[model samples]
Target: MTRGGREKDRDDPERKCIATGESQPKAGLIRFCLGPDDQVVPDILGRLPGRGIYVSADRAQIDKAAKKGLFARAARQPVKVPDGLSDLVERLVTQRVIDLISMARKAGDAVMGYEKVKDWLTKGSAATLIQASDGSERGKTKLHPPEGNGGFIGVLTAGELGLAFGRERAIHAALAAGGLRTRVVEEAAKLAGLRGHLPTRAGGHDGGVTAMKDT
Candidate 1:
């Protein structure tokens, strides 16, 4: 399966990574644009207007691109690379996820709390399940992610998920299908890649009482 969930679509827009020289879907790559001062800037939202350079989302690849002067080479001119480009990308992606989830909640397309999430799943209203990575595995296992690809996200910690839900903390959440879910999945894919994980379903049996893990 593609790390973003589901098989690769041939029609998807593709870009080549300057570091790896391999072309991949934009979903798996980060775009860089040259600033007015000719500094290489990581454009997490990919909306910058200029010639765009691409790099795979992996930290090592991004670091290699920066350390080996790949961006300067790609730009074909002197360009300053910001220190800790990969770390900045990671932070941006995480914030993008949080913003997306918050929007979804405001749109009435998402739900949190164990019982509410389980109810949505039982009623077949939730298209994706999100759980905190640092949450208790025992409690997490009590709720199964929706079946099939892109059904689960385990990349965020409890505090991070809490931020999205506007709560002190959250361990379980569910998203209904819509435009927002698509954006969430895409941003989550980038976050997952930077964090070196491809989200997989949480493994556990139903009917077991479990407690949420402390963050």
Candidate 2:
């Protein structure tokens, strides 16, 4: 186990990003499949049938791949890339993260609202702190993230977070250990990298830019 009692995968599979030519964990890369029409499709779940093309989850890396014909090269054949593929991938990954968080909430391992989030932070129950990308900075700065890397996610909007927590809107939220917290963290990290900004608090502040989202 790593910090926070999180299990560390000893043999996590790695793939090389076509854009960066760097090998990293499969969880930190986005998978793509060549559709029947020779169109490149984002396989967010990595279940699509085709020769898989891997790319770093960051927007820059995806853009580079499209601009430089990396996908066709990787597929070893000409493939048509859909316009706005990056945005599509971002949306899909965001929805996946939301769904995971919603499941966590249903399992009673997640909570929303400023008071509840604050309580979790005080009790050290929060393994990750989530804030909205469009939230206000002053409001977000009031609460500190857990002391560790990968403990913060700030990419979803307040309304998006609200959906996960079953509320009209949520500016702050916390994820406790267990449930889907590990998946949430992994996916959120990718989303954060792709968006080129961390999720913001209610007062609006870029948490920090990082690497891409996962499947």
Candidate 3:
């Protein structure tokens, strides 16, 4: 059986953001580790070999950490913050989310196109609904997210979603409940933060959708 809605794993551990000074689950933060030359490198996959310093996923927080030398402070040594680090993290996170969705598709846990997605949603086989941020608003609004929080993703462009589904372009898709689906939600949220605004089920911080819920 599928798990309930939401992405964060209770046992996954947590970290503190150097810029915000806020402690939260690791899913909502970005990890950075020092390179051989003591340069700060974003461990987008959290696999680098060094003690990790974390910052919130928001672009502003990352910029603050860079501009204020917070990463150096967190690392307790001088470190080089790469130029356009925010853009780097955003690109990595976007790729990560896309990769997760691709894996889900290969696993038969994801499907694209309006009818397939609608079928999956109505049948409760879909735990999450995904629509392209560039899709027609009228078309996107015809489908609601599955019945749960964290069940909607509307940040990716049609071209990006197409890459995951092996199509030229795709406007809508759905993810079946599983760890991959959850990972997609978690990473996509981080990507959304860095994007400053994204499209959710009912819309996103770019405009509407208060608290990330459809209400």
Q: Which stretches of candidate 1 lie over 4 Å from their true place?
A: 203-215
Predicted candidate 2 versus true structure: per-residue lDDT over 166-197, tens digit per residue: 77667788999767988888788778777776
Which candidate number has the best lDDT? 1
Q: In angstroms, how far off is 188's CA in candidate 1?
A: 0.9
> In model 3, what are the clashing residue pairs, if there are any?
none
List pairs with backbone clashes in candidate 1.
136-213
TM-score, predicted candidate 3 vs. hidden true structure: 0.89
- Which stretches in model 2 have alpha-carbon errors above 4 Å? 1-10, 198-215
Ten contiguous residues with the weakest lDDT in model 2: 206-215
Residues 1-215 of candidate 3 have per-residue lDDT tens digits of 11112455667587888998877788788999999998888898888898999998889999999999999898898899899999999999889988999999999999998888889989999998988776767777888897776778878877778889887778889999875987898888888888987445744234432221110
Alpha-carbon RMSD, each predicted model: 4.1, 5.9, 5.5
> What does candidate 1's lDDT look like per residue over 46-70, in tens digits?
9999999999878888999999999
